[model samples]
Target: MPAPAHRLGLGLAAIARPAYITSGRAGELGDDRDVATLRDRSRALLDAAYAAGVRYLDVARSYGRAEEFLAGWLADRPGVTGGEDPVEIGSKWGYRYVGGWRTDADTHEVKDHSLDAFTEQYALSRELLGDHLGTYHVHSATLDTGVLDDGRVHRAMAHLRDRGIRVGISTSGPAQADAVRRALDVRVDGEPLFTSFQSTWNPLEPSVGPALAEAADAGARVIVKEVFANGRLAPGGEDGTEGARAAAALAARTGVPLDRIAVAAALANPWAWRVLLGPVGTDQLASNLAGAELTLPADAAEELTALAEPAEHYWATRSARPWS
Candidate 1:
């Protein structure tokens, strides 16, 4: 069955900033990395996405003004501004963008999952996004960060949850399953703290699937991100990888682009409440949305599962992808 329109979201990770880790960004975005240029580009993509039936938008403090760009788009768009056509906005904190908008910056973002970091970043996000922000997540929560164990952070997130904002965690690294399991156990005021989970889940790294399914069973909203494996499953992506090659072969046989196939794979996950699309432009967004309409053959779906790589190896390759 095809994924519903409401089951898809637009993530502003690549367009809100000039340089991102997604492959083909250099070709898609070109040399125009200025703030104004990117802001305009972000708004254009947001407009296109909303028109294409995407009602959920994801951003982050570490995404180099992604929250600000989204705020601007919300303010400028008439129907969206007045809630005539409301869209759910989800943003992450705990990471500060230190790239200074430069592609060659030694460090792009710095993670600090401390309560102090949450207090400061949450205020900034609310100042910009205001009532439009429906959900807030810990940018990249892992066991090492101790965020799951931090009582202060849990209290703060719980306070937000009480105020009608959905609290969640966006997991990263190879131990995503571990993080999701840990977060599921977190509670505040004797109640579950996190009700939303955004994590990377693609054919190359399907390690988090079982844990995410458990989260869904626990009544948590499960959002799947990085479905393209940081663009490795997209058109002109790194086809040398085994998973990418399998996806490409399937695409060729089915007459569907590799990107769409990737999207279809993510949408096929019964536990996935929403699949995020990180397209650089309108054309890419259209191509990705088409995947929602695609229902892969059962044999093809089984073949894709065999392409799963070791979680550690998959993450290592993703880490080496330069921010271009």
Candidate 2:
């Protein structure tokens, strides 16, 4: 009689340190405090995240102060602090630092995922994410000829795995996630890399539907990020009523809100092994966790599917790039 692995994972996504309440940057996470200063705040957040049952911690090298801050706090802690509350943590590399200053505050940062960059970056991830680093990604790059040709990247990854690290890719698009899955299916030599794939999948795009199913069928673990349509599904602001209904109805049974409705919907995908979430503050975390505690009835699930349809327009245009 054991709890399921998915049940144990917290559906937590460690976004680029919440730099601006946006995906764009990691500087907004918080000003780099002089070690001792930010230390307490970082500890509090991670502590709360742990206590709340968050098992997955997602991060990236390009995420400004995020990885550095995490390395600051987590480097010394052992995995499985409490025996019963087990966890799996993941991080991504492949972006270069080159003196390390804040990138554009508004423009989204980039993911390199090249072998030369990824090799060094993975070293940094090892220092920062500790035992929580379950999966490593070739972060954010679309498929490239370089991915296959980089013997150094492959060798570096093999080195890490020989040291007991699990390696994978952080695909930028639904199509890319599929490509990673395909690669994993045929990987029979050396390290036997990447048992997981982390990608964006939710009600809005639903583009990940087939890829997720395929990944699951391939037995590659699927970790879904952005379950809330990047915050559109939440119940604040002048919008989200229709979105709220499905959640509210589901909440009739679970007592949470649209947040849980979204989580339930993502979980309903069966192909989804875990739903990773990002929260701005403590109150938001409580609400999301509360939602996590409930299950949606069949009717509620269908209603939720219809509710999410409108979410398609929430971010109609990535406007500049990778959006739209």
Candidate 3:
């Protein structure tokens, strides 16, 4: 098995925008969320992640200048952006950032999975990241969005695949299993259109495990996101829920932080190719990286497994979280 550090990736979601749905943002980022401040913070995080041996970087169009921040950081690093061992970069489309850099924006992003949306976002992503962009995913692709069933979108993504860029889908909500299974059936010119999959999988909500396993079996790269459940499992995070309480107890007994335990749980899944960590600061990044060193015992892992909540309840709690 590859070292956990090698399998860990940094997600630029929390730092790319002024506000996100993740908990503990107020304490982590405070009120200094201006564009330049966040840009600098993003660069600092990229520096720390690269220095710590984290190579895979996740970004998206709806992540409010995340792609732009990554582009700038890559430009500063000559050999890091290209060459044989360049960092693996994955980005997503299908949603437009509408927050206008405002933390109080009524609508932060608007989703449109149409061919037109793909065309526009693909052009923008290419314009910003250029060839550094490795895999492109459909942001929050659900069955109801018809993204998996859209033949035109598949053909467009197939064109990118021909150009050597891998295409995939990132799933969300309670129906992640349904979406992942459906995406597995998507084909273009008799070939699999998507070779990568990203989905939320933490100790608290692991309902998509079976589908992700099937995706990995199909030779798809399975990436786990929201491993900390949007900061609810992180230190100083919300611990009111039953799942969170159980995780806290386990963490207490094991003398490990909840964030590290969360990361270990996600990494324990053999099917996970890259487990993403969303950290707003270097301290959090360091703590999360240490999780890669942990060897979670089987019994302890099972104890955490008992923390699983119904997919509906998990997502409902997530949706109700205030965007700070």
Candidate 4:
């Protein structure tokens, strides 16, 4: 029998390029010499995530051939439904991989949300992912980028929707909440264009949750990213801030790992359809899956919820993250 697909609320992310990049031992993921190794590693991660009951996998064009890696892994799986694979794939455009897999590249990626960029990256993503591709989003849509206000882009998105492809936006920056609210308001000829959204929501930067809840209430599928605040809530994380301390206290009280408690907090949100797990290895993935099973006590949850930092401070700290 085929593996049953998980509900929309849980998924995996390939941002770490696990197999292709050597991580931990070196400050960087492995170099080009590690392509085969990285592929194997990513494949193992996918296998584990599926076994752990994750059905949605998020990747982006800027994630260094993540689309290709996902395609290779999905080739062997049968669809949960009759023809479509049980796994739902969500990939984004608007960012290009400029790193060439080199650790020393001055810039690893460059973001462009122009109509031409969408045209090119969409074709590239489609070519690489084929039928396995499910939803496509405009990566990191900001108020300044004006992606939401562009009629041409809306037309393109609406056309994709008409063809049965789900369209949405992934937002970044301090104004992420505002961006989400605007995205929810976008429409082409009376029908809403976006049915999905990927946004950041963690203890330190949860300013977007209410907006996400609004999106969810409006019938959009909401995927939460950065639940661990880019590892800030992990054990002995670099931030050393109050949010991290709260996570540690919760872990001690519950006897769960700090990471697990952090992720569990995000899962507790009813509006989050899927809280993405950015595990870099089998052990991390296992830890995250365990977190998914935890139900935090209401008081503990309230303590964690109160850890939210001002949106500006949170995004500033995020902006300074060393591009891992």
lDDT of 2 at 271: 78
* Ranking of predictions according to lDDT: 3, 1, 4, 2
**Top lDDT prediction, candidate number:** 3
Instruction: After superposing candidate 2 on the true structure, give the runs of residues whose Cα lies further than 4 Å from its correct spot.
Output: 1-41, 75-86, 96-108, 130-132, 144-152, 174-177, 186-192, 237-256, 307-324
> How do the residues 1-324 of candidate 1 rate in per-residue lDDT, one tens digit apiece?
122667899999998877789987788888987999998888988988888778899999999989999988888885864545578999999999999899999999999999999999999999999988899999889999899999989998999999999999999999999999999999888999998999999998999999999999999999999999998889988649877887788778888899988898999999999999999888899899988888989998998899899999999999898888
Alpha-carbon lDDT of model 3: 0.92
Off by over 4 Å in 1: 1-3, 81-85
Better of 2 and 3 by lDDT: 3
Against the true structure, candidate 2 has what lDDT? 0.57
Q: Model-by-model lDDT, in order?
A: 0.90, 0.57, 0.92, 0.76
Name the weakest run of 10 consecutive residues (lDDT summed) in model 2. 315-324
Tens-digit lDDT string for candidate 2 (137-183): 76653456466345566677766676666776666543555566555
Query: 149 in model 3: Cα distance from truth in Å?
Result: 0.7
lDDT score at residue 103, model 2, on the 0-100 scale = 30
Arranged by TM-score with the best first, the candidates are 3, 1, 4, 2
lDDT of 4 by residue, 1-324 (tens): 122224323333434342222123232233443557667767788888777678788899888867877777777665532354366889998988887765556687889989999999999988888767789999999889889899999998798899888999998889998999898889998999988989989887888989999999999999988777777776545366776777777778878787778777888788988888776667767776777667788888898878889999888877766554
* Residue 211 miss distance in model 2 (angstroms): 2.1
What is the clash tally of candidate 1? 0
- Looking at model 1, residue 209 earns an lDDT score of 99
The deviation in Å at residue 119 for candidate 1 is 0.5
